[model samples]
Target: MTLTLTDETPPKGFERLVRAEDPASGLRALICIHSTALGPAAGGCRMWNYARWDDARHDVQRLAEGMTYKNAMADLGLGGGKSVILGDAKRDKTPELFRAFGRAINALNGSYYTAEDVGTSPADIAQAATETPYAVGLEGGQYGSGDPSPFTAEGVFQCLRVGAKHVFGSEDLTGRQVLVQGLGHVGMSLAEKLHAAGAALIVTDIDQAALDRAARGLGATVIAPDQVFATQMDIFAPCALGAVLNDTTGPQLTAKLICGAANNQLAHPGIAGALHARGIRYLPDYVVNAGGIISVAGEIHKAGPGYRRDRLAGIAGRVDAMLTRAEQEDRNTTEIAADMVKEILASANRNVA
Candidate 1:
């Protein structure tokens, strides 16, 4: 296993970036620490089959920075960092790779902590934890937070409820048309929640089994992935990858309210404005999808029992407050949420100075 720290100039607000490789295990990964303002940098390690090394680096940087704002806005009192392992998750997962990545994390001391993100699981985290104690989201431990997807789904569901109340004048989701684009673990969980709330579900995903499962179990109407943007629906929950609401898709969306568990949903800041221009209540992804991080943070802080539950429930209240603030200021929810995070980060920096 070989670990390398980058000599390239770190991005603005980034503290460090490092790479790790192991030919024997076919491990190739990069980790970025975006901040240590509130506390130790904490985020998830995502595995992907990126087209290039630069693509992975760019993803890690954006994800790490997003985590900084996410943790801040969620009031988790933790800093932000993220890591990415470039490979096909299904084909390349190995205990050896995660262990090697664990060593890379150990090199950072406790300045950063990692949990499971896209293409990763508690099993992977457990493998990494064997090499270092810096990893969270493990199973069978005192502070273990396990899989964060369900927690994440719960947060999104609650926020979606409040958003529905704001837009539809009622929290009731009964008979509401909802499109769930992506049926991953988190997406499926959110779909189930919405279905239980009596929302008519339209689902799409790359996995046929996932689509079929939702069709059979949740009675969700499966739509082709290409048809997602054009679908007319009351709510569009993008639980898939980031940047789905870019320049093109923003105009195609027919949903009045948007909420989901995906991180960094907006491709750019201006997309938020575009959604607002269309009168869409685009709830900030960081604020509504913070349950997973809040759960992992419980493990990082070694919290007592019930900490995760209480913290997860608080996300709904934050969404409520953010919506009200946005209305009062005549600004988009993304802007309002970003300002809230900036204020917290600035206060932490002031105290540090």
Candidate 2:
């Protein structure tokens, strides 16, 4: 009946990791606040059925840390944090469960804010907000940013176009062979955009219905999940999970460019270099996937109309600029992006001092 929350020891760089459990609503959640150096941490609430408790913690830590870089890259005045509920998104979600989770978030005292993510929805966020004012992304009310998936898809679409220019010698995607790996809300929106741009889509997903929809609506060629890495395509978009571009998959990829909305696409530190050595241009995921966060941030800061539009428009410029700089420096784009994020953080610190 009562929510039980315990403060866990975070990893080296993390600020706090809180584990929350509530038998009343069957809620088991972890909220990680990686940093608040910029401002209150802002990120989404993901409800996934992780195989192991360790996996859930790792995912939250990686995602929260990725947000620190992502927010800085987007030029937002906020820090990074993330929360995850361990369960089946489809079968386990309940309004009381989300309210329990919301109480856990409120326990942080505004150090973090939450919205819809991977297995969560705007409707779920509305439930959470009933117990905490920090819940965001509800399109139904004032200052709510609504669903951020379309905005996220837009940002990644910009990266896709800009990356295409450098790799294919043209910005147009007409007839381009693109493999979209994942058909979730953001992934499906991205596929439609690419189909509109005339891209020949090769789609894969665990859900057969989603695959069928893509095939029926967009005329996409459905592929098995096992062949995702080995496929020869112009571009490979990973919209599902992180670390798909690891040592093994990176070498197997025949795609010219890698661009997607998934966070922490790189499995480890050196994977980017290997992709670069193979002459494959890797667009940094965080540098481009900040649209959803920017939308939520507008609500957090309560900026008036057009703020989301203006910020979303800047994603294209950042993607193009990063590409140009990477070419000029002959360095991997991830390194260049990290340096740029560091500069932004340092500048913020200096202004405070």
Candidate 3:
């Protein structure tokens, strides 16, 4: 089925949505540009075997909007955009396909910059860069930032400390029990950080190899993937796909704090309020996960690695300030973070006007 722009209303503040198909390469992709008020839109390109075209569209829309907020909050001088290519990552990737996708990005003329997201990698961005200069996160290049997963994990680790301090009255993770879902690159890196800090880890992943590796390498205990929410732990860190904190899992959550690297962790907007009502101090995903984009933006702008590392190191302080404000105002952290983004956007709009 061909993806079409229908009469249905677009997400509240999206600037543009492009659905494209390349018959030769069998590429079905959606690119969403949420805002360019601050600067050109920038986001990673995710490839997944979406169950439906609408699912891919929805993911792109939500993720792109989140990038807008993320970049704004990070003061990156970048707007928000995202691209999704529909396919099984393990089987469908081809040089021709990504090259074609690169052409599509180039056609945007820098309005949208693509990097690696879930099921995509820095190497894949390198492949795409063979055709477009806008591709980033490539390895070993002058401006290449390489894989950003480790940096992302570092930011999340810092945010976890901030949450610990706010909720448990200490910034230490020592002796804390953390349940980490999805042992992917970011998850594994985060697990290592937590383990090094003397945190007890309960981890789960769909891939047995990854699960075993985490268990053996990090001394983490293994749990069934579906049983994560029911497990008693101080922190539930979702490093996997989005929407894990949905209707089904919300009520079963045993964690006092929810902080992770997953974008759009809430299945619905209401999940934030629900978590808040349960006294779960939810760290906004974008706020915690902005490290990757911050690194990518710095690389693209020729900022040194030291500069990027400095910024990533500051994520905890930024998150702590937001969390403090949320507590003082008696508001959900998600709301507080969104208001911060909105204020930045408003300021940008005023400057442009």
lDDT scores in order: 0.89, 0.89, 0.86
Candidates in descending TM-score order: 1, 3, 2
Show model 1 residue runs off by greater than 4 Å: 1-8, 21-27, 49-53, 86-93
Task: List, residue by residue over 1-353, the lDDT tens digit for candidate 1.
Answer: 35555545668779988877777778888989899999999999999999999999899998999899889877787999999999999999989888888888888889999988889988898899888999998886688887778988988999999999999999999999999988998999999999999999999999999999999999999999999987889999999988898888889899999998776788989999888877899998888889888888888889975787777767888888888998888889888888888888999999999
- Candidate 2 per-residue C-alpha lDDT over 231-270 given as tens digits, one digit per residue, 9 for 90 to 100: 7798999999888888888899999899998877889979
Of the candidates numbered 2 and 3, which has the greater lDDT value? 2
Task: Tell me the spans in candidate 3 whose CA falls farther than 4 Å from its real position.
Answer: 1-12, 21-24, 49-56, 87-92
Which is the winner by TM-score between candidate 1 and candidate 2?
1
Could you give candidate 3's per-residue lDDT for residues 1-353 as a string of tens digits?
Answer: 22232223457788888877778888788889999999999999999999998999889997898789888877778899999999999999998888878877877788988999878877777788987888987888687788788888988998999999999999888889999998888999999999999999999999999988988898899999878877899999999998898999998998999889987899998999888888899999888888889889887788887877777766677788888998899888888888878888999999999
Enumerate clash totals for all models, in the order shown.
0, 0, 0
* TM-score result, candidate 3: 0.89
Report clash pairs, candidate 2.
none
Error of 3 at 305 (Å): 1.3
Query: Lowest-scoring 10 consecutive residues by lDDT in candidate 2?
Result: 304-313
